[model samples]
Target: MSAEIPAWLALESGLVMQGRAVGAEGEKGGDLVFNTAMSGYHEILTDPSYAGQVVLMTYPQIGNYGVVDEDAESARAWPEAFVMREMSSIHSNHRATSSLPAWLKEQGIVAIDGIDTRELTKHVRERGSLRCVVSTTDGDTTSLVAKAKATPSTDGRDLASVVTTGAPYTWAEGYHESYPHELGRAFDGAGTKGGGERIRVVAYDFGIKRNILRSLVHCGFDVTVVPAGTPADDALAHDPQAIFLSNGPGDPAAVSSGIAAVSDLIGKRPIFGICLGHQILSIVLGAKTSKMPFGHHGANHPVRDLQTGKIEITSQNHSFAVETDSLPDHLELTHLNLNDHTVEGMRHKTEKVMSVQYHPEAAPGPLDAGHLFSRFREFVAG
Candidate 1:
């Protein structure tokens, strides 16, 4: 085997772990968090919400399938650094166009493997997600620790701006890649039964994932994704049948302006939100949010849908959650996490507004909850 390249990850709390660099050779800094998903490393790497963050995967043996263009959650990789337990030396999947290490190198992302991720994850869970620095070139552990300490936390950061697209864009058409035979046989109930009038949906891009957009498109919506800071009036100008708020990073309270915009658009249009978007929506609805001790960052979290009384295994990645008691009477809880009993979803009683704390797109997780997108389409179609 080649000589292991030296690298280290230092946290603001003065904790430092040494390992070998596997991707690009350089330095990276961000808030460090751990994800427990056993697969979909590509989607996790490309997820825009991971921007300005260093992700440590708890699952050992990563990169078994390699990377594929079709699995990317965004146009570019966003995670500042990646930490894994082990890196597969050889590519092993037919769908893989390139290996994970090669892809990370191409994207200029720093990564390290063969680390004790379980212990690291436990530390993060105990102390909370902290600012961290990853360095391949700098072996000075003391200075690296200082740098990590000097790094500002995600508290007031407008991370959404850093990840959102500069311009609006559209995605593939139709609710499915191909029409299902069951839908074909079912009678069309709404306008234009034959083809059905496509719902016009506008999504406020606060670090949106490609899978979310794809899910929207799959639900028979013509999706128009705008920038994170796009004004409510500008969104209204689109005359969209419904509005969507996407998942993102950092504190929801920090994005006060976006919350105001969501508040203004509440009764004016049908709305749906997820992750950070869900927190913002809660704030708009006069609800409060609090940071979790460890935060949910995995694909196997279970949430119970209060409306349907069904349990769904979900993909979650956020550090904050909406306070269930703080929700106004106008809004009602729609789902709750089975593990911690936190509010996982909510919906406005009068307005066509709904949100979920977990990802329904399921890029690196289960697709059982994808029906939420169809519900949004139905709300817009009305």
Candidate 2:
């Protein structure tokens, strides 16, 4: 808690930056990545897709509004470490039950404030995401760099399996009407207005977020969350009308189980995928996936719907992308990222299967893409 305590961050490329330290002590490291979102620090921290990654906030100041219970995307923080230009000393929101510093410490996440994040983000953008180390106990640049270099990269890693739910369960919670709107463990709805003839959906929990489940429930789907490697027969045993693949961390190409499982599930029922799910679906659709030079991780990414030519401001987070050349004839591309002209959404021409490479349930982001969930429901109804 004193400014006298030294902290240092070291990149695999031999770049080192000094800063003030907070949260859990000792050294922590992960695949260094940056987010451009101005807010949603809590949601970003809790998102399971950030597992095994060190996240740097592009926004100058963080923790100004503090952390609230409603905004977490998962049960616990998943980022190995957190970096910020300035961490607020005081948390002042009326609804905030937790201070960012105490919360990070409690979660066992190493955090550094006052780091030169601008230069670090620029480095990642230009050189691509590199392994990095954040040390609060040891400040020796040489040792930190060595540790950073020793850290394995996210490439070929199946991080989703590590963060996935150990057992299958039903999710009935719906939209959060709270002040901050983060999905809480409690269901506070008063009536059954969100209820109806619930369409049964088998959701593949590839590090799924709570908001995605909330969105599914809001759309009247009775969701059964299964593990990342759940096969078609096990899922079909529940007699679900639809199948869903969730967003997650790491390379989609490495998930041979997911790809194989999805390949068998397609055409059997209506299916939908998001982020890593999208990439896996693409792989099963005879497409290839490769790591992006600098992956998209932000609240505001523009994607154009091919069918309507309308632009949607979306929240995105992923390191791998679908190769345009790898798409098969049966798959029809539906959305494209306006910034990089990359694939965003696609669907099988014949089967009731569709996927998006961005988060439509956007827990910490916009409502522009929410209609995609409705479309999926319609797809299932048909």
RMSD of each candidate? 3.0, 3.2
How close to the true structure is residue 293 of candidate 2, measured as C-alpha lDDT?
84
Residues 335-377 of candidate 2: C-alpha lDDT, one tens digit per residue:
9999998999999998899999999887668767877877787
Clashing pairs in 1: 175-218, 175-219
lDDT of 2: 0.87
lDDT of 2 at 364: 67
Report, for all candidates in order, the number of backbone clashes.
2, 2
What's the true lDDT of residue 60 in model 1? 92
TM-score per model over all chains: 0.93, 0.95
Give lDDT tens digits, candidate 1, residues 1-382.
Answer: 7888988988888888889899999999988879889888898898888877889999998888899887777889988899988999888887788998899999999999878998888888888778899999887878999999887667777788888889877766433433233332222333233456678888998989887876666556778888888889988888888999999988889886688789789888899999989999999888999878778888999999998999999999998899878888998999999999999999888888899999988765776687787677777666
